[model samples]
Target: MRLSGRQIDCIRGGRGVFSGLDFEASSGEVLAVVGPNGSGKTSLLRLIAGLLVPAGGSVALEGGDAELTLPEQAHYLGHRDALKPALSVHENLSFWRDFLGGKTGDVGQCLAAVGLGHATHLPAAFLSAGQRRRLSIARLMVVRRPVWLLDEPTSALDTAGQALFVGVMRDHLAGGGIVIAATHAPLGIETRELRMGSAT
Candidate 1:
């Protein structure tokens, strides 16, 4: 599968963020969006995920499910963990699995993969930042989405958690998925860079 964005333009809060930007990623490819702050990295991802409508240009995915739109076939993991503080770890994942209808995996196994098996019953409010991030990773595993748009995916992750996430991403790519990540830190995996703005 191939995802492409052409001549994209973004305007936020009545100010232009970016314009005439283009990007493409295929199956098993990791595209890292990097640049200084306010360069529209997150805006680009949001556009591709269909969260924000582009002022100009278009985003498309080829060789994907014809019945679904690009956003429907993609997973957007933003800076926020998007967890329910009132729910347990497993409950949170279960909610996502049910809400996102697609190929599903075992929630327990996914939690174990992300090192959250021991905290399956723990409320999200009591988990640390790193743990919250791990739980989000587990959410990704439980739902099958071909396109992953990650914004600072490694944030709040410790050394080991970051390393573990690398493996998770690798597994996703090995399964022929595409990852588009906006990050300041290294993803700890080989990726093509899509630098934004004028920063060198």
Candidate 2:
């Protein structure tokens, strides 16, 4: 399967990020989006994930598939961990499993993948910023989704955390999943760049 955006466009605050933009991301490919701060990299990801519609363009899957919605058929991991501070790590993941279509992921394995297994029972508030990022990242390892839209996935992560994220992205690609991540540093994937604000 593949996702292709032809002549895609988006406008934020009446400023055009890009127009007439074109790109394709096939299965097993990890496409990374890079740009300076405030360069609309996150905006582009949002558009591709269907979180924001382009001002005048089209984005569609290659296999006659219908368009995508914000959280349908795609998993978006933003800067925020999206964890409940009041809930324990296990409870947070469990709640997501219950809420997100009742599809359960390997909670234990995921925690371990992100090196958060020992703290599974700890409240989110107790975890450090870097740890919280890992836990949020672990959500990707457990949940099975076709597309991953990540924003600054490595922020607040230490060296080990970055490596773990790299591994997860590699695993996802190996499984024929597609990833579109907006990041400042390298995302450890062969990417087809989409430069925002360029002649699109």
User: What number of backbone clashes does candidate 2 have, counting pairs of residues 3 or more apart or in separate chains?
Assistant: 0
lDDT string, candidate 1, 1-200, tens digits? 99999998898898889988999999999999999999999989999999999999999999999999999999999988889999998899999999997999999999999998899999999999999999999888999999999999999999999999999999999999999999999999999999898422
Go through the candidates in order and give each one's C-alpha lDDT. 0.93, 0.79
The candidate maximizing TM-score is 1
Q: C-alpha displacement of 102 in model 1, angstroms? A: 0.6
Model 2 ranges with Cα > 4 A deviation? 63-70, 198-200
Model 1 per-residue lDDT at 6: 93
Clashing pairs in 1: none
Native-to-model Cα distance after best TM-score fit, residue 160 in candidate 2, in Å? 1.0
**For each candidate, how many residue pairs have backbone atoms clashing (under 3 Å)?**
0, 0
lDDT of 2 by residue, 83-175 (tens): 999999989987776666434578888888789889999889999999998888877766777788899888899887888788888888898
